[model samples]
Target: MENSIQSIPQNWYLILSSFMFCIGIMGVLFRRNAIIILMCIELMLNAVNLLLVSFSSYAGNAEGQVFVFFIMVVAAAEVAVGLALLVSIYRNIASTDINILSKMKW
Candidate 1:
């Protein structure tokens, strides 16, 4: 009872995560900057992570947290590889705009 008293409701988490995910989706769809797109992707991933953690806490289970850890690891790897590619692309074109990347065809 004490634990429940201090914890936030699951519904709140759901709403917040959903809002975050929507923002991420909008950013990805409407933005043209490569770096901004990557950041939006990360934001979407974090929203999912937040929902997972809320569910795990609501159920008193550890699996969600473990999955979140794996997700974070994957996200980190993705960022590393993505940034590397972006660096290579920027060096060639001097721009990070997605629209400009279409000219890279050899």
Candidate 2:
């Protein structure tokens, strides 16, 4: 069991996480749609979660995994609230574009 775990290098995990986070950042910055941006944020969170799990396993400790759980909880709440807000905005404007959000004010 232990040898199976150690086969992959820690560097690969770091690289993969960094790549995921960068993609998320790019999506959030370049995408105009609210839903796509929200999904990107989720991607970023998952990348961090992956990194945390990898470190926890490599270190033979549970602390990083615990942090990942807390992050997951927060991410879930964020998605719930974010989607609700998006739905409300879409109903009012009939669109989900971020630039049009300026018109959201009464």
Q: Estimate each model's TM-score.
A: 0.89, 0.92
lDDT of each: 0.94, 0.95
Candidate 2 worst ten-residue window by lDDT: 97-106
lDDT of 2 by residue, 27-94 (tens): 99999999999999999999999999999999999999999999999999999999999999899899
Candidate 2 Cα misplacement greater than 4 A, ranges: 103-106
Residue-by-residue lDDT tens digits, candidate 1, 1-106: 7787257677888999999999999999999999999999999999999999989888889999999999999999999999999999999899998887775677
Residue-level lDDT for 40 in candidate 1: 100
Q: After superposition, how far is residue 22 of candidate 2 from its true place, in Å?
A: 0.3
Query: Candidate 1: worst 10 consecutive residues by lDDT?
Result: 1-10
